[model samples]
Target: MTAGRKRDAVLRLLRAEPLEIVARELSVTAADLSAWREAFLEAGAASLKARERDDRDEKIDRLQSKLGEVLMDNELLQAKVDRLEAGGGGPFWVAEVEAMSPAVSISTRRPYGLARVCRVWGVARSGVYRRRRPADAPAMPRRRPGPQGPMPDAALVEAIRGVLLASPFHGEGYRKVWARLRHAGLRSSKERVRRLMRENGLSAPVRTGRPTGPRNHDGTIIPESIDTMWGTDMTAAFATEHGQVAVFVAVDHCSAECVGLHAALRGTRHEALEPVRQGVAERFGAVEKDAATGLSIRHDHGSQYMSHDFQKEIAWLGASSSPAFVRAPEGNGCAERFIRTLKENLLWVRTFRTVEELRLALLEFKRTYNEHWLIERHGHRSPAQFRRDQMDTMPLAA
Candidate 1:
């Protein structure tokens, strides 16, 4: 598709090279090379023909001028369509085409056909016809015009509201609600639940229009077994005595278990290493050298996580450092997700008087979360239960 590609082949043909030779050189078919050579010679021959003014020439000139006008009109119509789409009401371009009929004509005596006008403006012919129907014609249906579902719209919306309220977590989407409904012996499509949630404003508010770029990591971060990979992250909360304090957490990638939680007055390499140490002491027994030899620690490129001290400590404990992509928190989503849960159920709701108070609260929250927080990925099992079940099924000697 590069410029002068066919011309290069045609020039090679004109130089007396065999069509097959040129095609082989260019990696194109011999038929294509022959076609290009024929077109080039025909264009050259057409230019060399003797010409004079006559009726046929005059007719061709008139048609060329008309064609130029038609092309210019099409360009203008396209510009108008772009403006309408960007300014809101892009879908109503059929009405715009009908309104533009007087100005967009083939000639003074003959107006452009509705079909031609619709095509130029990228509007559908059916849309144009529907817009121009008799005033007394029946109106279109308000909804998508389909048979009713087993559940009525109002009932579905109420059901959706119930699902949202019953969930212990925030921001559970329609897909989860649909699954929950099916588990409760109700039947409905995911799209129907989505539509009902959207109409009633029961869906979670989410940020939109984020600049999407190429992703560095496109695979799952979750590992297949316990002690295989662990994700650690840090967040902040305000305390009456400390003003602002940092909270470090470590979570297992397989079971989503919050293995460690620590709140501190300052976030440093030493403070960040506390969670990893706590996790190793409890999960790997006595925190001896190489206790977590097979674990992979997933963290972001934070000052503490990337520090030499932190890397040395993780290696000493027998885990390898695995930092996520720059500015992408999703790479360490297990820890990131638990931080949100921590904020919603505790940090954002409670007022702590001191860093020690926050630390104690974090410890209490971690215990309850491991025992009660439902992970839908593991069939709504708690993290502690999931880890126990997974460890029981696995014969690994960790």
Candidate 2:
């Protein structure tokens, strides 16, 4: 019922009308009429309480106002007493007296006013005000201001754009872009590059709403030297005719280099070992027993990775099999990060007609990534370049 009708029914109830009569007249049930009447009575009681609260608040506000006035008067009296006790001396210089005033001293317990200090010093308050302002103060020009500290110029912005365009991988963030610019001999700070890219709407799209949990892994995935550790992982992509195919990759932990890449029709244990075989053949020459005795392979706890044959194969190649923590993908984080990059640059952006096509694409992507995709930790050098640079620094064995 409308509020007006409810009010009318409530009024009839207040007049002691029969409940059934009111309910029939309002076209409502007798129970509803009773509920409405109860609600009206409760609301009336609440309104009366609210008026009482308002009156109490008004009285409290008046008391607080009177208290503030009394405090102000007390402060004024105290300030006058302090000035009187400071000792009224003969006329003195306004600046000298102003300097000695407790009001000007930041450490004073109770500060006095400038006028009171001038009165105590027996100097004209007008003269103290006159000494405070310089005749040429308003005429002085403010310091000329411009951009500071190697601001992003037009050429730098163009260089940043060129870096993004020339990148083999997509979704390169500002920090990587800045590092690339520095590698190209265009000197600029990370912050300036970030600001310019943000202003120009050249920022990478970010994923959101990821739930956070306690970190289960803390050790670094990137080792101190190359060939010490290699992280391997598998990802799937759709082939137009063959459905989904698996792509496996192996990355050197220290150099961030894609040492091996393989795509197969099946994601079995045998397929997982393809990249390892390739990496072994390329890095350690022929794959024989104890050929890569000092090297280790890091992989997650997938069936393919934990299979007996897979473990046996790595042992035969003389490489140790290091399984990541059961639930922690970060233990195999280097491989996982490379897989994401692969998706962003290849799998997600293109479709393959067959497993063979995907294999060729994976090989091409591996070469391009090793030659063009810059690693920030490696002084913005490509993985291939970084590996070559490290090889130069290695001491020759006798």
Error (Å) of candidate 1 at residue 34 is 62
lDDT of 1 by residue, 1-398 (tens): 35488887788788888888778878889887788788898988998896878999999989987886677566657666687778865454666677666554444344565666666666788867766788798777568448787878888788778877876667777777887787778889888888888877878777575787788777999888887899999999999977988999999999999989999999988999999889999999967788999999999999999999999989988899999999788899999989988988899989999999899988999888898676788986778999899878777655
Q: What tens digits encode model 2's per-residue C-alpha lDDT throughout 1-398?
A: 69998998999999999999888877899999999999999999998886445887999999976765455445545555676589843456675557656443232334556765666445688887878788677766433245655643666778888988887789999989988777777777787788778877899888894776888877677787799999999998899999988889999998888989999888999999999988899999987888888899999999999999999989988899998988888888889989999999999999899999999999999999889887788877888998888888787531
| lDDT value, candidate 2, whole model | 0.83
The pairs that clash in candidate 1 are none
Please report, in order, the local distance difference test score of every candidate based on alpha carbons: 0.83, 0.83
Point out the worst 10-residue segment of candidate 1 by lDDT: 102-111
Off by over 4 Å in 2: 1-152, 396-398
C-alpha positional error of residue 382 in candidate 1 after TM-score superposition, expressed in Å: 4.9
Clashing pairs in 2: none
> Once all C-alphas are superposed, what RMSD does model 1 give against the true structure?
17.5
Candidate 1 positional error at 50, Å: 41
